[model samples]
Target: MLQTIHDLYDELERHRVMLSFQGPLSTDLITALLGAVERKMEGLEPDQRTRRRVFNVVMECLQNLFHHNANLTIHEGTTRTTDLPHGVVMIAQADQGYQVLTGNFMAGADVERLKGHLDRINALPPDQLREFYRETLADGTYSNKGGGGLGMIDIARKSGGKLEYGFVPYDKDKAFFSLNVNVTN
Candidate 1:
């Protein structure tokens, strides 16, 4: 365990990671993380517009992590909020700009649907993507999490890039879904 953590730290440092978090994805944590990232970027990030874009993408990703994360096992007699919805988020600075990576456990049944959704989004041109965003918004449809693809559409719009994603099977009923969004200044 110690060696794994050490390796992880080394990899992150090599890539100039600015922020990282794993475990519960809660509203409180999201608020704190946004604050922390803002402060950290003050020194490293020079462009205010770029920082805003990064913040918006991070916010959307964190919301997805919070809303769609599958429930984790809680110890008997423990409160639900005590465990939180397990997820991971990391931000790293690269040559172009910043990369936001987020992951959360999701039901296995969702993998295909999400893959199709992402593929469709990726296939869209910028103008059409914006149109789709508006159309979806006007449709008044909601997923189980009360999102009408707004978070994802916003992420793509803000990032100015395709949403890259993959799913690793966690068990018979669950999979770990990972998403990557890049924001270039």
Candidate 2:
């Protein structure tokens, strides 16, 4: 099933460059995804700054998936069952830069809070964002159910761009939060 999804994504990548993977969304899978990205990037001539920014953006995006995914299922010996939370992440090459996209389900309140946070982060200048991130990390007072209130700000600062976000209403109580980060190479 995972291979089928990967193959479909690969077919779509012919027109637009992309590196995509889907699996159980476990910790092992996250490690493998990071390794795969590193390997793919090795052949390219990405400069040091671009490489570091891309790595940070990808890391934060995957961490978001680890925290927010709604459906977590484990299959053992032909029996499939739900486990923890899991979601899908895709990183693709864009005309101007690399785009990291992630999607996971979120409650309405969480969505609103995330939107507000992103807006505030977008409004901050680079120096203010850096200071805010440092202060938040040092203070350690703000933490969500998943922890790490600094991930979004870190992503924004590293990407050096405003986060492109969307909340698609999936039901009365839940919505899908999609985030995009673009890192120019």
Q: Pick by lDDT: which candidate is best? A: 1
Off by more than 4 A, model 1: 1-10, 72-83
RMSD of each: 2.8, 4.5
User: Worst ten-residue run, lDDT, model 2?
Assistant: 72-81
Which residue pairs show backbone clashes in model 1?
none
Candidate 2, position 21, lDDT: 52
The lDDT of each candidate is 0.89, 0.77
Tens-digit lDDT track for model 2 on 1-185?
A: 99998997777676354566553466677888888877766665358777778888888788778766655434664424355455667777777778888887766657878888899999999999999899888886755644568899989988888899998998887788888898876
Stretches of candidate 2 off by over 4 Å are 1-11, 72-81, 142-147
Candidate 2 TM-score, C-alpha based: 0.82
Candidate 1 C-alpha lDDT tens digits along 19-103: 9998876688899999988888788889999999999999889889887866745588684864578888999997999999999
**Would you give me the overall lDDT of model 2?**
0.77
TM-score of each: 0.88, 0.82
